[model samples]
Target: MVKNVGAVGDFDSAHETALLTATGRNQLLDAMHWIAEGRRLNGEVDGPTLLGALVAAADAGVAGAEPALRTAVRAALRSTLDTSADLVMTDGIVPPSRYEAALANVARRTASGTLVDITGSVVMAAQADDPLVIEALGLVAGLSWRDLQARAYARGTSLPGEADGSWSPSQVFAAFSVVDDVVCGRVEPQVPGAVAARPIELLLGGTASGWAAAEAMREGGVSYGTLLAQRDVGSAWSAHRNRSNNEISRLMVRRVLNALDEAGVGYWSTEGDAAVAKAVLGQRAGASGKPPGQLSIVTRAATGGPGYAVLIAIARDGGTARKTAATLLQLPKRFNVPSVLVLFGTGWADRGESDDLVRAFGGRLYTEHTLEQLAEAASTVGTS
Candidate 1:
């Protein structure tokens, strides 16, 4: 089933009154913000609407109508909110000073109410934590989830001289890198069990249809796969590989393909940032087992062949870099595949950007001097 990330239309259909009624003014407005920014509010699974429904149900006097919804609410709280303990809340307006207490109270209420007695496999409440609670508050309070991740990195940003001292360049890059991974997650569209490509997905863009690009990264990004074909073109330049092909983009893709073939990794190339975004994000997903975390490649250009490629991540999660740039040598841990090195190069047939492609993507004149080095760099760019 295709899933939509927003609930504006659903909210309108669910609530029906076009004017954004009094009782739901805050709720509707909050819901609208989420819908406008592209997040979901459905009453099913771990969605924002589940919380709204819980409050609504409680307001409506339904005692157990919240079991399924409650479980889902708790699950999201733990995963997205950053709480490590079972979630809890108090009925009244939560005071800033008593936020922790409010959570504990909610936990107590839950433990005494349905949490302690849940027997179905619908939710693993025991493993549920407080981070989940905060996320619920984030959605209800109208806070941006993206800001939450930014705040996490921001913490590391303010620590005395050691802040800049410890953060350095790569550390800072790594923190935001983490934020990049989290903020844009589930944002890119998907194509049947795989994420689809997107033109302006979050901060980075990619080629391949959002869904097609994501699905293209099978094997958890072990190979260059489709994830790197077209990502927000960080660099670009056109080349006339064959006068017959003519356009800079075609030359870029053909060159990239040739490089991948030389490295023995397969790929799914595309023309736009959407398709590339689909591929880049897909490489980090496993869909089964562990979300794919290594051997990455990200190539996205502004429409010129021989586009720019950035060494986003490398040699991570016991994997090899089938294709990716070299400067992404920012992350600490990397899993290198000497024989299965991941390589990346982007550009269109219309313009010439081979210089940027080489510099950012890494190879020849870029960062990698050997297959071993390149393999390691590309492998971890996505996961780290």
Candidate 2:
């Protein structure tokens, strides 16, 4: 059992002694907890001293301090550490190996939501060749494109280059660029366990099977749009296609949103009647009419490449096809979009009716038996 170590002395010197002494797991945890208690008592911890001690503990293979270490890291990052002085300093108190281990332990912990704001600091402070750098790259890969770009842009001021083991300004910026490329799908993750997480993967119930299917389709060169379309394409086109457009349509709408998200496509769902009235026709389709599922999306050309604007409609077999078609056709004029896609669930244009509908809507009509198929088709058409 360890006795109360008393007040930490000479911030810099005590840091090194504690680091060397806290080699065992229990000792490391105790040291970390002590630091936490110190912070509680002292109102704040000396950033360099705390980080140096924690990093040394991590280098000793002490796993128990991971959570507390992450918290300290978050607090450290949130502090107004200088991009040059505080953030990049690795000379006196922290050696390269210890710094690397400390960073690695922090990155190993998954951070989401508001805690994610610490990303920019971590990136700015990271040294090249650190394994934690790889973990940092992985974390950014899961962020939205806009967020990724913002991160890259935030590192405007460059840190001075190091002569020895630390990362230089150019090296740090280059790492950010690589991470951005990976998120954009222009470059793939080369490191193990560095896979990017799509928004759909965050779903607890549907994640496993959905991710597996998505992976299979991705390997097959299937765009998320195409995959969604194919899923909605019912095995048989008869009664399956004609099913009522109630909860199923709502469900299909959800699936479409998810598929687009998985593909990193940007979209906004709009109430069919209102969107059409405001953007297309001069008047609402009908006040009492059941609104269809409508969305405005920018579908990716290549995986993570440029996005193309498209107006999409999810219509039922009822009398909604013509109204849907009319609304869709006018969208290009209003939104200046080049493509409009209409997904139908049963009872759309019949055999004799096909020619007229085809001529009117420019043949972008696709029949879907299920919402999954519609989603696949949307992806296919959008990508194509």
RMSD of 2: 34.2
What global local distance difference test value does model 1 have? 0.30
Candidate 2 is scored at a TM of 0.24
TM-score of each: 0.17, 0.24
Name the top TM-score candidate. Answer: 2
Please give, for residues 1-384, the per-residue lDDT of candidate 1 as tens digits. 111122322233333222122123355444334433434334332222333333344334444423423332223322111111112222322344444433343334443332222221211221133323333322222223344445545656431222212233433343333333333353445466855322233224345332233223211231332224322232111111122222333333444445545644433344355355435434432122221332234332222221223222222111223232222232212212111222222211111122222222221222122333232323333332
Off by over 4 Å in 2: 1-249, 261-293, 300-318, 351-362, 369-384
Candidate 1 lDDT trough over 10 residues, lowest sum: 234-243
lDDT score for candidate 2 against the true structure: 0.40
Give the C-alpha miss distance for residue 107 in model 2, angstroms: 68
Clash total of candidate 1 = 88
lDDT of each: 0.30, 0.40
lDDT, residue 276, model 2:
51
What does candidate 2's lDDT look like per residue over 1-384, in tens digits?
A: 111122222234344454435332245456566544434424233333344445444444455444444545434322221111111112233344554454444343425312132344455554443534533343324442234435445655332232233555565565456454544445445688874443322221232333233233223343565435433542322222333334344454555567667655554443255455333321222212333235434444444532334344443343555555555444433333333344534334332233333333332333332223324434543343
